[model samples]
Target: MVFFPLTHQIPIPNKDIISWIFDDPKYYQDEPMYIDAQTPSHSISLSQARILVKKLIAGFHSAGLQKGDCVCIHSFNDIHYPILVLGIIAAGGVFTGTNPSYTPFELTHHIQTADVRFVVTQPEMVGSVLEVAGTCKIGKERIWVFDVLGEEVPDGLRSWRSLLGVGERGWEGFDDEVMAGDVVAARLFSSGTTGFPKAVDISHRNLVAQHVLTQEINKKPWKQIRLFCLPMFHVAAVPIIHTSVLKAGAPAVIMLRFDLAQYLEATDRFAITEWYMVPPMVIAIVMSPLAKNYSLRSVRNVSIGAAPLSRESQRALKGLLDERAIVTHTLKTTIQRASVASYQIPKQNHKLIDDNGNEITTYDTPGERKPPSLFTTTPNQAPVYIRGPTVIKSYYKNAHATSQTLTPTSSLATGDIVYCSSTSQEWYHIDRKKELIKVRGFQVAPPEIESVLLSHPGILDAAVIGVKIRGEECPRAYVVRRPGRQWEALGEKEVRRWCEVRLARLGRF
Candidate 1:
């Protein structure tokens, strides 16, 4: 992992980014937080969404959300946020949103991390927790909800309606009493390539500086046009769409998810100027029929991170998009919204050098080991530094993990091992720096899978690994059945049932 302070080398406190959004009163009109061609176009804008967010803060306050309180949000990118997060910072609460796909155990892990007293969820995800909450730590009564499928909130649950319209109530100052270097936003439960999943805390400064950095470094002028598939959840998105794009007053055509047809339609529909995509997303874009059918007249570039793209994908991408549109790599610090940095991949690193001609030797590598030159010393684990804008600060309430991942000086010890070409000094990334399994695209920390397996009555010791099937990969665990245990007597087809009951599709083999 590169040791330079990815965040502000000078530490700053965590605070709401609402000031960025609410600053311009004139532009605060209701627009579209979500624009989908799928239906009538479910939408919310900066103005109205924040209004509800403001109300939620009020309701939370009236119901008593003091400083340092943790409020969990579980929803996909609907038309509600840009403001929902703004309100969380404004309310003096730490907003921790969980992946909707989490099992009850994973959900509980984060709840305990943030000490979350209350939860806001959609109906479909409710059963996972409620079925197990009594045995867990979360306070079930504190859940307030949004209707799933437009249905009513379940009995004994609070509706999101009761939490809103705090506009009539005078706005209060932000919750969390933030200070420079203080923990601001919590994106809990990340599993580095080597360890168990833990929460990640991001500071306010970490969030903002990178937003500005993206604008400066990526050559993204607020005035230029931008077209992108939705990567709404990360903090990097904040700097661009929420901060730079919105502030630049540029029109951003959005996609509900990565769809080749939708992405192409969006470019043509909006005359998109740039593309912010992950590798897989780019791959899909390249393979999609739209790549040929649509003329991206205004499309300029495609920015990507996470796993590195092979030379083959890079060549194919430039050929598919306009050749002039550059394909660049994004290095985002691992956090809620990570700090994003960009670098061009060298067909051969030998050609590039610094002003001194000594060579810019900081290279990113393939797995958990640190790039040879980046580390001051050696490390205990592997790190996978992803590409993007906003990087994480620390793991939420996971001091050990935070300490394990983020050093006191602010070098995010990404467990990902990177490699720098000795000849050119440029960086190239490989896979996870650790033993974590990549079931689908998401990381499934091996230790976590092992722990769950051991917890089951049917299992004993277990080891998990990502096994390749045909050419694709999936997880296949190695097991040592309980001594003298009979699979037939258990009457089960598979002894891996423990993992089956707990892991999501992403974690399953």
Candidate 2:
């Protein structure tokens, strides 16, 4: 009982990501493509972006970057982030990104798992990155400081600009279908069912397919000005900011970090027509007093994803927008597109199965949803799997992890539980089959936090779980005190303070 897309399949372009972007005439305009929200003057037009990307491609090649080599960017969102991503792929290197807030321990895991050969980081993050680089055996020569806003590089450190060659080197575009489908463009880390971050290999074909399918389904006649407040490292932001926005000829306002006041001001200042956000940001807008201070009348379309937004919250958020504005809820996984409207996407199909590995054809019945595959699985609140062109074929350098998640026919085990409504023929999300916790929009694995907590001498045993806190999912921890009287003095406040310094903001319990 495989459910196919309601829409017809569209032809996906067979070209490298860079070639697909540059070859499109729609993206050839001189208008601003990426604008720094804080410093409006610092913006890059399409032509300027192309030249910078070309320079980066040449730079990467000069720096001994070879095909399939991985280069990591550990920095806050910037106007030039997209440029760096494109440059890496254009040069036949795999681009990976890390959370800017990651501590040395977390950064070490990312660097080692991705096999990062080169690192581009902000001056402020250079210390931690360097520390992690040393732990990962990456040399100082391969690490560069990226002053995204200012031209002055920190003393005694090479700037990312130094990688740029004097002239652009010609990029050999991929015309072969097999090459385009197999070439890995990016390696984004995701905590799958294993509750440990594993590198997911996103091929050039996945990028192109997603870009095409998204554009085909969403046909907007008006020019779109998009606000990018979501972290660039997340899977949700990568395809949209780097590929879709560029191909759609939209102007994106880049925010270094999510400051509510600044976000509202930018929306008003830029007259942002379309943007993507998570549920917590939506909740903030609806509940915050500052939301009324700025003008959000210009925003007409808002897409919320990463976590589920309640119907009540969705309705409340719409009141803050223009009268004609519509709020769309999407559910996107790291490996595949799991939107409620995914049935409209071309070449996509989904199905539902019960615990006995039987397909559930009856609508309104909750079952573990999976993409139709030759493999059988008996499993969540009932796990939803999806098969599509955008789904990754494997996990980078992790054949065991890949084997556990992907079926022989390439259907991805999404680890999401959902049910389809009989009347509307739409999917509804219930819960996750995986142990990963969704805080705001970020994925926080319990094992990662539990490991940190176990390191404390005061605690004998620790367990972490997700709990609904004020309309958002937050991590809650339970611990057992050690037998020693010295451990009795360890208070919750002290433990929390210790964890704050060691863990990322989202991972802190």
Candidate 3:
């Protein structure tokens, strides 16, 4: 069973990302929306950000940068990152971000993969960037330093200020030839847990459409104060949080790096009302003793992304915070496919099949022995194919991957499995196709067992992996105790009994 929220709809503009975000007259000249919490002075107002974007674009044009070019951002979180990203988009260029922790070799792979024509990074990353630039045949002149306060431009390099378009206070937008549907926005890579990462081509239309869709699900509040500490490279960070802050004209409090102490401090200091974080961070906060010392009562809602959150953790989070505080699980269709499929599995154009390839009509009835997967469909009864302006054209230059992932009509098989409740039609995402565990002739999802384990009061975090014991494959769990808990008091036997009480017959250890 699948259901989508029936929220009020809003008009999504058919224009470049620059115009789409800043075009809102109400947001224009608004006070500093993007706040660098670490350095309050560095925060950018909407009007200031727009001016910087125009200057950056004008500078790019003056430096002979052309359309369809790519810029790779390799830096930590900062106010300048958005300006740089929007500037690239406004200049009709594709922008890809690099993980700051990436090694020189990993850096080289991403820079070469994205065909990065320009590199914007901080002073600390210059060595790795220079090494990768040497291998990728990129010129140092095209590299600039940002987010490095008061640092003189090193020899043979430039500062971001140098690229600011000096004379263009009121430069016009991108060339008229650039349309909303044009393939010029983001080049995001998958998490690559299964294998090497694949570059996803996200267009301006896909981004704007996703923004509008998000607005329906995440209703705008009267006063918006967003907290962003996730890595900017992830889809949840840049595409979702960045756009959300921009569209809502909210004050985005940013952390240069995620520190639990600083995170708790910020919650109290800012009276942060909105929160977004990954599952591990959620566990860290819930289990941390220091969290109790902070006054986080102002937070009205929290969102978990990047991975699934067990119901146990969700419940615990709500109890730890305000019972009324909304805790939501935000799922992205696929990292490699930068598009919004239904958040919940869609009933229309989605079905489960048995071993004989017969459709599984009722919920809770396990389908045939095939691997598990996820489901979604557009409102028009289409198979959630990669249609619309927001869908990517293809994986950058990888024809085989592109062919296997994208169908002739442009829809993608997300390669995720889901379980549905027969009566309520509520979709429960199972595991990835490749990660499904076959135990005693029954398919068991790791997340399912992990969810059950996390429900135990003693356990804070848990991961389930399939292991062979006595020539029989069974589920093995690695568990983390809540902070300050003694393991001896709650041993393996207690853990097994906890699982024994909750999981179904075949799912037990």
Q: How high is the lDDT of residue 309 in model 2?
A: 54
Q: Residue 66 CA error for candidate 2 (Å)?
A: 0.6
**By the lDDT metric, which is better: model 2 or model 3?**
2
True-vs-predicted CA distance for residue 356, candidate 2, Å: 2.9
lDDT of 1 by residue, 1-509 (tens): 33332433322223345554455534536655344444425655555555666686787787677776777777655445445555565677776777677777777776776577667777877787576556555665667776634777778877666767444343443424335236464444454455555556656555554554445444553235566455455434655554444444454665546677877777776667777777777667664666788877566766776555544556767886665677776545456244222333111011212223232334433343323321132222233333222445556656776666554544444444344443443444433445555544445555455556655555545667778898766667776555453643642346556557776556665
**Relative to the true structure, how large is the alpha-carbon lDDT of every model?**
0.55, 0.78, 0.69
Clashing pairs in 2: 368-382, 369-383, 369-385, 384-416
Q: What is the overall TM-score of model 3 with all chains considered together?
A: 0.85
**Judged by lDDT against the true structure, how good is candidate 1?**
0.55
Rank by lDDT (best first): 2, 3, 1
In model 3, state the lDDT of residue 480.
79
lDDT of 2 by residue, 365-408 (tens): 34435321101211212455567788888888889888877878
Candidate 3 vs. truth: CA RMSD? 5.1
Give RMSD (Å) of candidate 1 vs. truth: 12.3
Question: Mind giving the per-residue lDDT tens digits that candidate 3 earns over 284-314?
Answer: 7876788889888777778776676777667
Where does candidate 1 have its weakest 10-residue lDDT segment?
345-354
